[model samples]
Target: MIKKLTILATIYSLFSLSGNQTLYAQDKLEVDVGGALRFNYNLSSWKEGQKNRGGDFGYDMFRVNFNSSYKEIYLNAEYRLYSEAFGGGFLKQGWVGYHFNEQDEIQVGLNQVPFGIQQYNSHNWFFNLTYYFGLEDDHDMGVKYLHVDDRFEYNLAFYKNSEELTFGGDSESSPNRYSYDVVGRNKEVNQFNGKLIYKFGDSIKSRLGVSAQYGGLYNLDTKETGSHNGLALHYEMNVQNWNIKLQGMIINHDPKNLPGESDEILQMGAYGVPYEVASDFSVYTAAVSKSIPVKLGPISNLEFYNDFGYMDKKVDRFEDSFMNVTGVLVSAGKVYTYIDYAAGYNHSWLGGNFVDDFSVGNPDAKWEARFNINIGYYF
Candidate 1:
């Protein structure tokens, strides 16, 4: 953050010294500052002790956002502060963009990868299972080009690498990040992404898109570069106030590891923790939601949604993973809340053990449930 502040100050000084007062006067800068404070209550079926002791409610996160623009140049960034156990503080995303007319633009710096869906594909707070695998809404340090028209949209991006933490010497990448990335002995680098979306229909609008990505997995132990690739087909449709989303994807990872190291699993880290994942897998997801407006005192509207995802491993003896979430979002002026009942089987972020749940998980593991409610006030 200090670095960003210094850069802004330097730019101001240079502009003032150049005596270009008219240049600034012609394009008055616009800025908007906002933030949110959130809290959560959770009760897990797997955590018998916590359930017996009457669940738990605590602070979730506090985030501040900035959106500023001077003519065709714009900047957007967000900083978040989580609890110490949840990775402390980090920059969620920061990017500078330039507009070349209405049809084209470019974004530079840490930005979202143009893969899977735009912005986000899920309706609930937990998102879909693809998010945990770093396939949905992942961000990295890179540059991207975007083109949009009435019927088509195109995105092309090249990421040099994932965001790195300078203070952690023992690991190649920090676990204290908002998005999951390849870590441990291998790091994600030199990634290329392309996506195309076609929009059609009138009253019942629909969008069909295809996305693909290829990247290098640099193995620290072997000092060699391996490869990984993914392809996805996604479709979204809206009829009346109902929304439907569907997606399928295939991914493969090949890493060069030292002798005796298994190649079937890779390490992925985020939120200040590391976990194992199947190197090769296929994912399928479907979701539906309905928006209804009501006059329930302070409650103005409600959105009911259900999201589901499945992960099938390619390894011969590996087990599959599944996740489902049913919830409703309540909106009352500046206050918003989500009430969710989420369940999973052989899922890492769910109920199973942390590190190996997505790797070679138990084939007979039973489904576990977690009931949660999250509330936030935005300003």
Candidate 2:
């Protein structure tokens, strides 16, 4: 009788281990949790006496990403817990799509717009002038198709409303800062973006691409309509341990009525500007970086980079602006840090938070300095 009981116990133990293995094989789900904490020590000065020096923090949130695959269908979702302005939490990216092989896919939801570059070339965390114009690091509610092969890579997208914008009013519930939109008055409608890049050469890898965007803005109050369109050309190359990138674009804004419109009325899209007529503008950006093979303590790599940007608004009484930045980047596993010195004149878009000249009616075009130390850690 004792021998019979031992045999039964052995059978039970083997079956339990086999069942656990079967469950693991049938339910193949992958989950990753990662986030970043960004801190900054800034000393910035703009107009005389308009200066501030202090510590700042941003995007300090925890994120969870989930993924699962069933044959040709793939699912992805991400959620974040961070600072909240409106009622609900912020949604960075969430999409479900079909994989047409390993190189192509189509996704629908909030995704990055394929405009100039996927991620602009800059060591500084603030990005370049294009971001201020709603072109860089800008994501919207849209449908996107992405394809990549040996010859070229492409992205085609169609967006709904131009994300939410804060409209007129000093009411405590202003949503302008949250959403990079106008005072809730002018909203972009029927927007489309397309980008394509072709790669060639074996030894010297080079890529060139052109991008375009077309959209319309509507003023809810006056029922006025405006149109915006632009074209951009970009080029990049990799040489040894150095990388070089360049991009140029032209953008135009055409409103229904120019001078006849309300003088002090809040204009949508373009910030700190009076829409007098159809104005054409241009922006040029360039950057170069070299990676040095040196390690210090926890630092695994060191890089030195320089970034420059220039903007020209072909309008009377409006002066052109330019910005230059030089910085050193340190990478230690999942942690990265940048120490930079930025100086510019009338370049409000490139200025740091405390050195902004956007509010000044007419900037004196005087050069100012920003000593910035940005540190970020990811897990």
Candidate 3:
């Protein structure tokens, strides 16, 4: 009887182990989906010379992620959908990744170039208020590798160049009107990036990284070629209640253009903020409640903060030149509410000679302003 009882217990233990293994295997294949919706109202002109004001509400992003692992092999897939103000849906990202070993992995599909911090900033809804400086939401089909270990991480990728479509005014256009292929247009672009992170003490840490890209353009129609280069410097530090980040970039556009064709600039910015607030519920009795606290839950769980920003740029003889200032105030919780205001002055320059002065006069640069309010929910 004792031998029979021992046999039953061993069989039960084996079944339990098998069940646990099946559960673990199931958990390895996981899928998730999420997205955001945004509504924007533009009380001012869209750009410099336009006279029409507008507003739009649409899906900001709809994305899904798939992760699976079998034995020593791993796989990942991500997809994103977006719509513009004019009403059309487009695929933002579609990518797949494979893991060969614990420390190395490769990905291919449409993905963002792993270049700088600004390219991947996650703090704000709109990336840095201006879309011109950083390569915002720009991606291409490519292959990437990631080597991650204890003290260092490296990312490298080569991707199919993206293409831009140009259209003619006020009518249906042919699919082959004018297309700019970023890859075929450029000779070859290779991006290299690395990060060095060190931890000193329990609460303080820092990281520094440098990234660069070099490539040339190839004109499919004209068979012309051009070169391009971009470099960035990034650094961040976290200490106690403060976190700081600094980034800078130097870019040369159309370097292969004639004597005055290329445009180059150096731009940089830094941000620092406290990690946490001292008071759970604090009311400021001021003219403008810079910090407002509203009960997000039974406990004083959530708070709201708002700020305004302004910038002005002045350049002559440039088609896309303008001077502008913008401000935004936002609140957060289960839902987000925000307001944006912007104003700008725009003008054009025409070449002329001193004596003859055979040049058209600059039109009165228009003054444009826009006010937008948005409410969104996320899960």
User: Whose lDDT is greatest here?
Assistant: 1
Residue-level error in angstroms, candidate 1, position 36: 0.8
Clashes (N, CA, C under 3 Å) per candidate: 0, 4, 9
Worst 10 residues of 1 by lDDT: 16-25
For all predicted structures, in order, the TM-scores are 0.93, 0.77, 0.57
When superposed on Cα atoms, how far off is each prediction in RMSD?
A: 5.2, 9.7, 14.1
Cα lDDT computed for each candidate against the true fold? 0.85, 0.60, 0.37
Tens digit per residue, CA lDDT, model 3, 1-379: 0011112212211111000011112223332333455555444354433233344444454433333333333334344344432223433444555566667777666555666553433222333322223233445557777776766666787764442223222221111201112221123234333333332345756666766766554433344555555665666565653445455555444523234432222111111100110001111100011333456553232222222222122223322322233333344544565555443333111111111111121244454555655566543
| Candidate 1 local lDDT, residue 142 | 94
Looking at model 3, the pairs that clash are 44-369, 44-370, 161-183, 185-217, 185-218, 186-216, 186-217, 186-218, 187-216
Residue ranges of candidate 1 with Cα displaced over 4 Å: 1-26, 167-171
lDDT of 1 by residue, 137-237 (tens): 78899999999899999999999989887735346887889988998889888999999999999999999999999999988888899999999999999
Q: TM-score for model 2? A: 0.77
Error of 2 at 364 (Å): 2.1
Runs of candidate 2 with Cα error greater than 4 angstroms are 1-27, 47-71, 74-89, 165-183, 257-259, 262-279, 349-363
